[model samples]
Target: MLQKFQVNLMASKLLWTIFMGLLIPTSYSVFFNTTTLLEWSLFSISSTPIMLTLILDPLGLMFSCSVLMISANVLKFSTIYMKEDKFINRFTVLVLMFVLSMNMLIFLPHLMMLLLGWDGLGIVSFILVIYYQNPKSLAAGMITALTNRIGDVMLLLAIAWTLNQGHWNILHMWMLDENMYQVLTITLAAMTKSAQMPFSSWLPAAMAAPTPVSALVHSSTLVTAGVFLLIRFYPFMSSAWWFTPLLLLTAVSTTLMAGLSATTECDMKKIIALSTLSQLGMMMAAMGMGMVHLAYFHMITHALFKALLFVCAGSFIHSHMHSQDLRWMGNLANQMPATSSCLVMANLALCGFPFMSGFYSKDMIVEASMFYQHNLLMVTLMLVAMGLTSFYSTRFSLCVVWGTNNCNPYIYLEESNPLTSPMLTLASMSVISGAIIMWVAPLKQEMMLIPMYQKLMPLILVLLGASLAWLISATKQKNESMLMQTQINHYASCMMWFLIPLSSQFPMKLPMYLSHNYLKLMDQSWLEALSGQGINSLSVKSSNILMSASKPMPVNYLMMSSMLGLMIMMVMF
Candidate 1:
């Protein structure tokens, strides 16, 4: 126990120190409106400097600071959360590696070196996801790893395609002869990593991991890696005429899908996971609209709140005997006051409550996006997604309040320092980080000149969504009603419009089915009989005949053999 405390204490201090160090310089960079790109010339190839570049710009440093702060708190939180587990040290090491991978991604801008972080995120995430080592965890890990491999392959192709350019740095890409292929591949890679449409099945399934892992991976490490990648490439990728439309479709589809799914989700972790998907789409949509800074700004703000939400969720889950279903949770607000308050703050931030951290970024992104887009259908859908975000948050709160079907009346909440400390730390940031970030980040203020009614749309959407959720909760205590009441409707929305099966399972079904049949029809049938049983039986029979002939060969068998040979020879003559 003492050892755990000491290790976490030292680690947290180290991370916090590093975070502060980065934060100071990043603040100075933003304040002075300066950008620094330091390159070390490793060697020269064809007179082209094969240099290694480090990006110390406001974006990367600020993100790195956010990641480090969150990591420090999460490590502190995990010390208590996994207290009963025997292998807590292993967990600590894995979390550290996860943070290391993310930092690698943040500082390194060279495409070749970027894979050190990109693939590291995938590998470490898979290991962390399957840390529990059960069948379900293994399945989730496979889905996560396999789905991400698509992006990795596309990234490799992008790298190879740019190999002729003599350098793989982001700044050097503008000089390429043809960049569309690289853009397409890189976009595809980002979509998979960010869990965009058709590649989003693994995001919710990733809840198989521990809550701390979920907080880190879902918030700012694994899933956000894609958004960061696109941000690094946006100046170039968006120049392609088709990039915006493609990204828009991917982003909006993911947003709508995740929004719909979250409203119907029963699992608390899965609900938050879906919300992460929703926010990732928001970032992607902001990127799609050519608002790179806005997307990044939202990423930072979302990371703060989402990490808090997961910590709070972890506390509730720990209090509830590890049951994750909303129907099984109740009275947490009364029992775990601090954690529950933090939970409320996180959800309110998610709904873009007035002047909160999320409001600064999410509202601005949506408003600026709506202002830029002329399409009425897309605008309505975006509003629907915004509305659904509130609806699900309200539904979640309602269920948490009323749920008692699976709760133990005698259970006590453990609101220890390890639990409440991280929650409060993140909660404070989630509330005010937006304003702080706005002041410190490069874009001090963004002026969007949208009309008043459209600008008021977000408030209207929130009120209507919350009202709808209250109505549903009041009317459907025993029998639930949803946006769609039919069996098919419920299934469609809950399954993310059948994306789970299509993206994760459908691709492997044919190959697995063929292998199953081959085992049954070939390996177990004639092949098994002939190569296994038949050969064994034939060897047995031949051994018996040899045994019988061996004894007779000493006496009468020799005379018989000689007579037989002589008779055969005379007959042939």
Candidate 2:
């Protein structure tokens, strides 16, 4: 009966989510012509009014709708995925909290309110990441939380800097010159959340969480928080002279780095995660080009397909008894046709196949880059990153779905309703979201009379990448020796160019060394001796001397009695 009640409760929650998901888009369409900015003053800090303001602009509504739709699907999916867990209730609550936090982040324009959502995401995500209670999960959770905390601290710093303007609402303070520090710090904060180059390791490591969490938090909502923040802050950042170049450099580097890493990754989820990193870099690059609308479009479309990909991968992993290594997966198209089909569609979308969701935004981003007089190196890197995205995605599909059947015959692959339902929804969105988003949020590109080569650059690079992937796949079967021969290259690619190890080692090592040397040596030894132990010893010694001095001494008592008598006589006189 209790179990039945739990099931019913979960179903009701899912129904409510679906209702909200459907309601948002409908309401958004009806109110499409209107832009509403609502603010309620929460309190005053000194003389500055800290307000909770919500902006219902087209962008915010679209993103909020996407978050809700995806979240609803994730919740429904989790009901089945987490059915057997004893702590399903706790998990459900956390997922709901995550959803709510993302909603807060999406709608709220105030930095203070945004921080509430931002910190909520960080804390909730940390709990979710470490839900498994293993060492790897714990470590991953620590890294995820700590990395996000850096972003959180930066947000706080931005808030502190914003206080100089005597307002917490970012929209009111549009003058860029006054808030350059705040803008820069906020961008840096967003970079950490989005898992840009230096902070990229945690995204892959965070795969230690449950697949449902991965599908919801890492893939769709949480990771995109940074992009969303940047999209909102685009106006302020536009006038900053140094912001664009710095962002472009970082985004392009991250794009290339993550693409290379994905190609060598063996873990199925991590490959997808790295691909996400690469796509985010692309989005950031687009933003750097001052194409905020285009970046927003890509973000929405990417969320749909990326979530779908993660869900399909989760199903695959669950069927394979939680084995996530792609080497162990092959010919799944024959075994799990429905799931494999979804995987293929998601992959094709990711590769930016023609007319697909990814293509709509990705093609535009490339074209827009060409239209703008960008640095040649930047343009080349962007194009190469696109190709590498296709290459790794194709490589992944070949190994996991279409290659030889590598699993044992005895292993059973289940295709249940709960597993396929959410994926089907996402797959449908992956197919059509590009057109829907483009139609809704139409971005006008300048008609630049560029050469055919310039316009066809993205498609050409994609084909090249596809061909290379095929060649590599074909060669891999014939001669495993090739990879063995190029040991150095293999290691570098596998280690993500040593970025992972360096990020992991340096942050931990330096802090630990400082803690041991400074904390233990100075704080524990010297400070403790002087302030704690030494002070206690001195007090004890002083007490002992005072005790000895006052220990019923006849002279001392007589002197005290005589002084008291003399004082009493003086008072009487």
Candidate 3:
């Protein structure tokens, strides 16, 4: 019976994946009210859809579709990816938990319930990331875990602040009042979760996990949690006057920085992971600038192509005996034709080539960014970011598909179905998804594409970037930078000096730095530090003193003599 129970876990996990994938479209089909010919009078028709009403907006539907599609592919891929692993049972359970949690997160009506689902998803990702139990992988898992917690803290603070202002119901919350604080808190939280700018390094380190984990968590669902939060709370976000401008600034900077890193990165997974961060930053910028449609479009397109790239990379690794570094790979297009073709198509979508899904939404985001405030520097930064995105994206393609091969003898290519089928499915989606989305939702009427000259800029940047990256690769100029070397050395030193020690010294330095300035900023603006700390300490100390005094006292000879003397005096009286 125990063996049978263990045997059934995998099937149960897979079943849940299928169920989650179908739940959204099924719900939408059943609940979409079409009475009175789609648009009635000022007061539209009434509909009471079960749970679907929680997050039934167009943006919500887009994320629902993304979560479903990615969860399905990850589950199928895991079946083959975890076949030989010892912790398959645990891995399968966490995968199912992650899927169910994310599905619940988008539909949660109450803020607390939404947070519950959000934190659950993060926890499951952390567990899955460390499934290999290697030293470096464990460290990577720790980094992701801590960063996620920091993001959660900001969200919790925002929720508490909202509740303090007597706004427990999000629908009734007003953004025009003193809601700027809440907006800032939520924005900070979202940026951290999405791996924007200074908080971006964690995603690349997360590549230490197995390919399936990276494909599902980093590329598909987990990193997008912040964007989902922003989209879900768009009404409140739109209320903040400064929020859009700030988001635009951060997005442009994050995209450019991540793009630069991606150009020099050699790790196959790391390059895609960084690019995902950059792309997500652009999505946030779009949403912040009131381009929700463009944001949703880009999110859908990014999910398809990023997942395809990760899955195809997995296939390449499985075929080439676990080699993930792009520098040592060359001419794999001829060797793994199916995998190569999928990779090329996926990369094309990422590059925003003509007629691809990425070209539609990505161009929309850049255009929207340009229209908001129209700062020349921000526009230039965004353009440079586009070029960087193209440069690194092309670098990834060149190394994996067209580079020289140093044949490793121990590598054993997996059987075709194990490596090719799932990848082909993802790759096909990468190609077809853009067309389907374009047909389903035309952005021309919604976003108003940028002028012809403006559109030409990104294309020209793309061509220039691809050419520059190819030259860099050909010239053998790729080397680790001083900053990167310092980071690697610092992390190495920590593991060697502190992690090896017997004491419980935590890896809290990074967390401290991120939380410090923000906490200080909050304290200065809202609460006083001395009073809060003093009151808390005083309450604790007084409670301890009262507790000590409440202990029972012993009665001995001294008490008895006093009682006897008192009794004699009373008798005399």
Q: Name the top TM-score candidate.
A: 1
Write the residue-wise lDDT of candidate 1 on 399-487 in tens digits: 77544445777877778888888888999999889999877667744577978998999989988998888888777763254645788
Q: Which pairs in model 1 have colliding backbones?
A: none
The TM-scores of all predictions, comma-separated, are: 0.91, 0.88, 0.77
Candidate 1, residue 333: CA error in Å? 2.6
Between prediction 1 and prediction 2, which has the larger TM-score? Answer: 1
Candidate 1's clash total is 0
Between candidates 2 and 3, the TM-score winner: 2
True-vs-predicted CA distance for residue 329, candidate 2, Å: 1.5
Task: Give the per-residue lDDT of model 3 (tens digit) for 325-373.
Answer: 7777778877778878888888888888877778888876776666556
lDDT of 1: 0.85
Report the lDDT tens digits of candidate 2 across residue range 1-573: 444456424643664666576566546653554578888988897989978798877777777777777877777777666677888877877887898898889888899888989999999999999999999999999999988999999999998988888987767766546778887898899999999978888999999999889988766688999998888887777778888888899999999998887877788989888999999999999988888888888998999999999888988888887899888889988899999999999998998899889999999899988887888899899999999998888888888889887877788898888788888999999999899766755465555677898888888888898888888778667312233348787787777778878888766897888778998789878898878597678757855675577867788768666765786588579
Best by lDDT: 1
Model 2, residue pairs in steric clash: none
Every candidate's CA RMSD: 4.6, 5.6, 10.3
